[model samples]
Target: MCSCILLAALKNADEMLKDIISAVDTSGDGKIQYEEFRVFVEAAERQLLQLFRSIDRDKDGRLNKEELQAAFRRAGLSVPKRRLSGFFDEIDLNHDGFITFDEWRDFLLFMPTNHNGSPLEAAFSFYSSIVTVNPEGDSLVSDETLEGLGYFLAGAVSGGVSRTATAPLDRLKVYLLVNTKTSSNVAIAAAKQGRPLVALRNAGGPIVDAIVSLWKAGGLRTFFAGKLLLGWSRVLSGTDSHAGNGLNVVKIMPESAIRFGSYEASKRFLAAYEGHNDPTQISTVSKFIAGGIGGMTAQFCVYPIDTLKFRLQCETVKGGPQGNALLLRTARKMWADGGLRAAYRGLGLGLVGMFPYSAIDIGTFELLKKSYTRAVARYYGIHEDDAQLSNVATAVLGATSGALGATIVYPLNVLRTRLQTQGTAMHPPTYTGIVDVATRTVRNEGVRGLYKGLTPNLLKVAPALSITWVCYENMKSLLKL
Candidate 1:
């Protein structure tokens, strides 16, 4: 009798809750889309869940401190100080030390905790909410698209690094792009163990075979065969690029009295004021964003040059320039060998590569520069954000940090290149389709087969990334982008 009574009450409560949710769902489409769902309910649920294990307080969508504290209070449980502080910090969810309704909403939807549980489950649940055009549910993205995106990011990083670092990076990428499986990380690991010789690559292969081996063996931090030369080149490139852009930007301005940073400040101030936002610190952010834009443009616009370079480099290992005779001869040979389309074989990979690589590299550099600037300012008790020297210093710091990000994310480049440029060389009896090429490579070579040439790529990454960031940062500072 007692069990039956409890079951009846639970059923009633569930029906009532469903009725309320359905009422708010309003569209009566029988499914609550993530964007269309009641915003408050989502927020409330997340907060309540994060707060306590049992009760669904506020019933918004998430668990918050309020919901947690309330549940504890109702249960007469004591809350520890340490737990309370963390809850306070996250209550706003915006990293802004204050809780807003929108932040609350995001917490409900995005917080790792929450219903259906598991981030993967939540993601699929949200995905089901997106409006799709497929009437019969046949339209879907394939693994190929995801793989393509990965390769694209990789290509972007590799290509971007090339523009930033120049010739040595060219040599480095060839080594790294060999085949991803050769991670005899005796090089990277050997550094901490005091045996540098273990990291060296073998000789008698290509133009820069020995250098390529050390790069693969050592990875990024220790892979600097021409470390000093790379650094000097980076500095020179940055200085020249920045100085040139800066001079140009100033030349067009009302510059009888205007100066470098001053012109930049004027443009930023106008935009912020026009948009009715704070402009003081924003001037610093503009250049970083602009540099990112520039990186993407340069990468895509002259990417054919990059494609040509990669093909040239690969053929060098296979036969050397003697096979094509010279740059002009090689260009003619490549076109003749594969026709027009073969010359642009890896474009999709390049496109995908640019977005993530540039975004990560530029974003990280900006963040680091801001951190360093603040640290230095606080150390010196200097509070002026618009100070000329401080801004320039921040730019430099950002450039260096951006380079490191590029290095870390460099392997994707090797993967994309292998996937795009390898296989059916546009000749007869070769499966020329991207999907067909990828499938054959995996089938015959195994999964590791796809990751060829990753080591030398990793080694080249450090300097290549370093130079890329420096050039970007310096250009932004100069161009006031």
Candidate 2:
């Protein structure tokens, strides 16, 4: 297993070098002259400068042994102080006890070609090189380094962007979700408010009436009523899933990172355990199974934050001051009610939903992407893997998978939200368990009740997921991820 992963990593490294060469060989000469090499190095120098500044957290012009050790730790590696000191001694060519920008740049530029060792050592060396590049230094930026930075930034920003952009739809979904029992009454009340739009209610079904009522009662702003509350609640949790609809791209960013990372890690470990090093011989189901496991792993890490965010969205507020503190108050009330357990209500159901949701979402996306890539490759006469799908294909496929996965197991989501918000000061505990929630929802509001807020949910999720995939893919291409 270890040998297999090592071989894979080495193969990846070789491909990476090829990509770097292609990117730097601007003249199409097949061979890079000294001048071409200088241009590539110069471009890399910019990233090295950023890296230097990062390591020099104190804004100092030099990096000490301590700083180098800290950088190693930042790159997900742990190195002994003694080893780092020896490494620094070699890097500090002037015997100056500290590494200057020039020395740092020279070390990276003159990196040893025979540094490859065991996979673990190679991984360690790779990450150390990555985190050591600071803005204050004069190191060169490799295409790979730039690509990595791009993925990190893209994942972080895309989540918040998708969540915040669809905030209005999410707010509507939550409103309908918590008020399903009283949705009709609320629409009637809105009609009684003498808004001219009330006439539309008579022409439509209950869902349409509710929407019209909400519009008449509050106009455009009503759609984004508690955005602040939702954002703050999610932010404070330091986890993702603050979108009020449980689909936060930001949180999913880390979730994705974890999912993919864990999948690879698990694959390597499993192959090692089974004594199978041949990569091509792996089963196709491995990807789907790995994806499902990865999703569950991510869900476990962020489910509590998700629960809190859901409860806050499902809060039954009635004409009180809507301030930022409401989130804190709600959190405190949950703490007072059942301690930590209250915040984790419905976690079981969430995990159950997550398993299949993650499996289908990731598997379907991969299958579609590959199929699209293959078709495009055939049309364009290119390698299948090298084929590029248009933005429309990426968006449509992403939206379809998201909508399908969410719809397939939507009842679990609805039940989870209800369980979290139930028994709160505002919304009393009605259902006893998952079964109870399901039974009561069906008994009280008919089968359709289990799908409350689904309209706005699909509206919000389809585009949000689409945006996430589009942004992620585009960013990956831009960074060459």
Candidate 3:
């Protein structure tokens, strides 16, 4: 028959392919049936068993930790000791501290096989390729490295976009924070200038006055004055630009990366110490502590740049420095004034506020997300693990959490900004220390003074946090974290 001729030609085309097909076609009828396929799978499993026995060097019929490590080495794979231990523990399903032949066979068989190699070879090759060393004998691919990269890229993109989008609000906040002039005074001044519309805009409130003033100084461009340069500088040089617009991706990237990376790392460390294999199973208090630690670490590393950015933002009110050399000039001046101390002026207060703020922000978001997932699962009659929150829900949760954090820390932020701006050419040294700043602010403007610019701050922070969380989660998913 024609079919018989075609089958014969197919079998003759490649010897290796014909052998594979024939191995699975145990019926020897040049066609594979269910019974024949089942027999082939049994044969493959038996071969896996043979491979396992070959690696059981002591002939104890079980693989101890040492033997398992030796097998990987013989396969020309180098794994971290910690990772190997985890692997070993996972395979020792009964917690017996050793892998029996049955366990080994089950693990090997679960791995997807490749046509080019046996199941055992495919599994080993896949594991080996997961973590690799470059020509310089340094680790080039690993879980930690990949996770950090994911955070870094996500942070950079989210920070840049969010900051750019909320730049006007940010500028308004900084302006209101630094300038103590009341809205009434601004309105009266504009009225005297015979600009009725300007006076009306100023009369709307401090937020309106700040917006109008910024607009008059440089039109609409003033809102995003320093952001463009910051973006360009990030692309051209790896260094951050002291742009007051808060769009410095180079600056934000490292801080965001460290914050998220350290948070995950801290959670893992705590989970291990608490005898939990999964970090997500850790307690809420533990999550809060981990988030606080991560926030502190990130704040410490970027505090100086933050101080510089605040100072630069304040400068926009007076139209101080401009162009590429602005950051260097500012740094040099700060160093000349008080050396390293000047650069870290409000760091103490910053840390104090950051701890609780970060703790609540991250912890609340996690708690909400967990509850949301559970509720969704319950409603749909599905497993909790199978439920996922929509992107809009994620953004809303992030915004709510961020707003709460920002509100709690707004007073400290105000004090820090005041302290950083003090002793500059415009605002003379009015406070001697943190206490002095707090005392003067409360003494002069009452309790509400501590919350100066809270409105614009909320406006800026809510969207920024929402955008940040959405982008970060999406990026993590993209990178398969």
lDDT of 3 at 285: 93
**Which candidate's TM-score is highest?**
3
| TM-score for predicted model 2 compared with the true structure | 0.59
Q: How many residue pairs clash in all the candidates, one count each?
A: 37, 20, 0
- Report lDDT (CA) for all predictions: 0.43, 0.63, 0.71
On the 0 to 100 scale, the lDDT of residue 67 in model 1 is 57
Residue 244 deviation, candidate 1, in Å? 26
lDDT for model 1 comes to 0.43
User: Each prediction's TM-score against the native?
Assistant: 0.41, 0.59, 0.68
Q: Per-residue lDDT tens digits of candidate 3, residues 388-477?
A: 777899999999999999999999989988888776643555578999999988887778788888998998889989988888777766
lDDT, candidate 2, residue 451?
85
For model 3 the TM-score comes to 0.68
Models, CA RMSD each: 20.3, 15.3, 14.0
